[model samples]
Each structure stands twice: as structure tokens, then as C-alpha cells.
Target: MACSIMVTAKQFFGDPITCITDEIPQKVMDTYCWIQSTFTLPHQLDRVAGEEVAHDGVGSYVDGQHEKKYHKYYQWVVFMLFFQAMCFYVPHYLWKIWESNRVRNLVSDLNNPILEDEKKTKQLKSLTMYLKDNFRFHKWYAARFFICEMLNFVNVVVQIWLVDRFLDYEFSNYGTEVLSFTEMDSEYRTDPMTRIFPKVTKCIFHKYGASGSIQTFDSLCILPLNIINEKIYIILWFWYMFLAVVTGFSIIYRCILCSSPQFRLQTLRMRNRIVDFHILESVFNHGDIGDWFLFLLLARNIDQLTYRQLIEQLDVSITKKTDRESFTISMDNERESKDEVGMLKIEKVDDFKKF
Candidate 1:
């Protein structure tokens, strides 16, 4: 994920962004770019992020020492299941609200071809047109939504079961290790504190890998736990992939809906402004794409990761162009000031001064 994001940032920023830490596997990058280009974001629109202005530095150190340590959430799995159940109720409520809104607008204007002078009437017309064009789209949307909800419910159950089993097995093995220590010669025990040492050592090895006093122990003792962890990891991969597919689909759907020229223009304008602000902020902050990338990488590494982490990682890359950033910010601010004073204004190309 980190490598993919770095590639994206490099494309967007129009400069080199290194993977000094190699936090992301090369195979993962290959799969990510292939899947993203094949099934999700096309290369054409992907160019937009590359053209945007970047923050001050393209690559820098990522500090994560202050970040919270990853913790398992065996209990939160129940809430995930509950949340999926609640989603079943949401669509119906949303349908009622949408129907009422539509009805209210229709009642206010009986004429089929309403006057364009009324803003509310124009909105109703737009809504009608949008619905007419998208009704078929809605059916597929609802079907996908329901399928995802049901899958989430099933996943929550499976995740909770698997995680709990893994934890129990881990602790059971630790208990065996502790018991074995007692069997060894008392002289070899070294100290009373060493009794608690094995568990702490185990966790440290899991995170940092034979570093700084918590070196690897006998492989025979850890082989079973390592095998169990690997199985748990395989299940986690599919879960992560499912989440990524769903999120990528959602981004695609949104792009589809916003493909209209007006919407794209507005989105482009808005994106430009955000990049500008970040770059100005970056001049003083000196933070680079790595800060954002690292945050996302850590988030992805957590036990129950979400696609939003990946999205955010890509967002930094996609929005890395500095020129677009400055232009957008300036244009938006200009438009905002004009709107604030109740005077209609459209900016001319000459209004922007070259830096």
C-alpha cells in the first residue's frame, strides 16, 4: 500500500518519491497498480492527481512513535455485526425521506414545465432529470449495498471467531512455555523477573522482529504459534481485499455520477484550492508525502483495517501537484469573496498572476 501511494505521489507530484523503508512489498505494488488500472481508476483521470501541486518535500521521514500501538478488538466484532444489521433499517428510512422530499417539491409546482426563475423549481427539475437517468443505476446500487451488508455481517462473525481462537491458542502456548521454564534447572532461570519475560518477549518479537534485547528464541517453541498466526493472516488478506474492492467501487460510482462537465469543473476547482492551502502550510511545516503515507500505512497494518486507509493513501498521491493546488485555492478564495458580497462574478484567466 505504501509503495502504491508513493508511486501515486510521484505521479501526482511529478517528482521522485522513494520507498526508503520498503514498508510495502513489491508484489503488493504490482497487484495494486494492476487492479487499480484494470478495474477501478483509469490512467487518464489518474493523471489529474499527478498534475496537482505537492507539499514542500516529496519524501521525508515518517514519525510514528507517538502513534497508538495496535490493539486487538475481539469485542468490537460484535458491534460490526450489529452495525450491519442496522444498515437494513437505514435504506428504508432514506427511501421515505427521499420520497417525501420529491413529493413536497412536486406539490409546490403543478406545471410539468415549471418556470426556471424559481431556484426551488430548478432544483426539482434537476432532481427529476437525475432520477430519470439513474433509476436503473439505483437498482444495482441497492443490490450491491445489501450484498455488502450481509457479507459484513458474516465477516464480523468469522473475524470474531478466528481472532478469539488465535488469541486463546497464543496464550495457551505461552502457558506451556512458562510451565517449561519451571521445569528447567533453577540456576538457568536467571531471575524471578524472567518469568514474565517470555510473554513480553513474544509480543516484542511479533512487532519488532528480534530487535533491541527481545531476540528470537528457540524456533521449535514458536513454530506452532507462527503457523497459527500465518493462517489468521491469510483470512485477514481476503477481508482487506473485500473492503478495498467495495471502496474502489464506491469511488468509481461517485466519479460516474459526477462525470457531468459542471460537476467535474467544480470538483477540479475545489481540489486546486485544497492543494494550495496544504503547500502553503507545508512551507513552514516541512512535512512531506511520507507523513501522510506513513499514517495510512500504520492504519492499514492494524488488525481490522478499512479501505478508507488506502483511499487516504491514494488521496495524498492523487492530490500532490502544487500548481493545481495554488491555482485552485486562489480561484476558490476569489469566488468565495465575490459570493460573500452578493455580487455575481466570474474570474477571467488573466486574473491569476504567475508566481
Candidate 2:
């Protein structure tokens, strides 16, 4: 969308104004020809021929010719802008597909509160078992996630290269240039022309077959569009660089988190502390953390051997609590019976025992 907006602005408002005149006076052409004649020697025909060849080889010494080349690739620049934006979004689309198929279904089953306690426990146990048995799937998912992040980094790098290649100068160096804050003076740093776009340029046009002679016309023009392109690319260059840096860190963090045993241990300790694990189903169902949780689930599966140990510990804690409750209930029942019997006996046996 941003790319589209920039392209539109360039087409309508960024076009350069061309210089116009009623006609080139005959006196001006006569004077130009006289000046040209003075710079040449008709007697030295070979020398003049060699000089013309050299001049052509050196390519358009006039400023107008040089500026003409700048506008030639404007179409290519706009095409790349839209292409780069689409490339950056590819990873996100892949993640969405994975989330919809696998993560959402699992979270839904786990979070269904209407299910009987035994069925819910069975479901959790089955999920844990599945995770333990399918360790390879976890590793594969982690690798896929890492690849997606690296793709983002690659997209940014490619975009930076494209900008430099097309602009062919320090114009695309805004990312690095912005770092040297202390070295740059205020006027150059703040100059709109320097940062916004290239405005003033010379353009040359040829009038052909005019009285069987070619005439060259040069004029100064303003390319308002180059300014818009400059500003858009400068911001895009830095934004992509920052995104790549963040993605690199996230990949590292995910690798470490998934590979370590600590994460599983932490999950085990925190599992029972959750009052409503079902509420977290919605969180895993959507949002940024959903992908992370999917990876975590896969990681747990990979270490099923160790994860089963945590499950055993959980089972032991549940059994101990159930036993304690049952013993307390039995003691309470026995005490109540004893009190009722003693009251019905009228205390005759208590007096005999004291004697």
C-alpha cells in the first residue's frame, strides 16, 4: 500500500517542469556555429576526426545528457518497490497456514471446560504422550520457524542491494549515514534537498531532420518524483534493517529456548499454578505468541522422555492430595460416630473405668 501511494505521488506531482521557448533565434545558432568553428581547424582533418571520436567515447560531456540517464530507470524503481514489499510478507503467510491447521485444533481441545475431568485429564495425557513420541516433528517445526525469520533478513538485504544498484550512488546509504550524527553539520543534515529527493536536473532533447540538420536543446527541469522516491526508499532501507536485526535475535532466542531442558521444567512448575489454562487457549489461538507456543509444544514433544518425568511428578502430587483428603474424611466420620455412641450410652462405662 505504501509503495502504491509513493508511485502515485511520483506520477502526478513528481514530474519535472520542462523549460519552454517560442523558438531558438537564428542568431543564436549562427553564433554557436561560429564558436564551434573557432575550436576546430579545417586544415587538420585527421586530428579533428580523432577528437570527435574521443569526445563521443567519453560520452555526453554536457550536464543535460548526464541528467537524462537518471530518469531512464524510473519505471524499474517503482516495480522493485512493490516487489520488495510482497517478498517481506511471504513468511507471515506461511506461518498463518501452519497455525490454522495444527495449533488451533490442539488449543481448542485442551481449553474445552465442559468436558468431564477424567476426559480432560485423558486428553492432556494423550497430548503429552503424542508430544513425547513425535520429537522429530518439533525439530522440523523449529527449523521452519527459523527459516521464516532468516527469509525476512534476506528480503531486507536484497532490498538494500537493489536500492544501491538502481540509484548508483550514496543515495541509498541513508541507513549508514544516519549513524554519523555528530560528524555532519546542521545544514547538510537538515537539508530537504539532501534527504527528501533530487529536484534540480538538466534534460536534453534532440530535434531531428530540421532542414536536414540535427539540433540539440538543453533545459533545466525539476524532478519532483525523484524526491518522493528518495524519501520512501530512505525510510524503507532503515525499517528493513531494523526488522532484520530483530528477527536475527528472535531466531537465536527460539533456538536456545527450544533446545534447553529448562523450558520444559519451567512449564511443568507453572502448569498447575494456572487457574484457568482454558483461558490461555484463546491466546494461543491468535496473536504473535501463538507461533511461539506452537514451537514450544514441539520442543516439549522432542524431549518426551524428560517431559514424561514431569508428568509423573504431577501425577504424584495429585495422588498425594487425594489421599490426604480421603484420610481426613475417614477420621472425621469415625469421630462423629464415637461422639454419638458415647452420648447414647449415658456415661455408665466411663464411671466403671475410673474405679
TM per candidate comes to 0.20, 0.55
**lDDT by residue for model 2 over 190-294, one digit each (tens)?**
333333243443344556674879876654344456666666766777787787688778768766655664553345335443323343332222223323345
In order, what lDDT does every prediction score? 0.35, 0.52
Off by over 4 Å in 1: 1-117, 132-137, 168-355
lDDT of candidate 1 over 137-205, digit per residue (tens): 433333344445454545544544554354433332343354466787763442211221111111111
Q: Give the TM-score of candidate 2.
A: 0.55
Error at 12, model 2, angstroms: 6.9
In model 2, pairs of residues that clash are 14-225, 131-301, 197-227
Position 202, candidate 1: lDDT: 10
lDDT of model 1, residue 206: 15
Name the weakest run of 10 consecutive residues (lDDT summed) in model 2: 37-46
In candidate 1, how many Å is residue 315 off?
A: 41
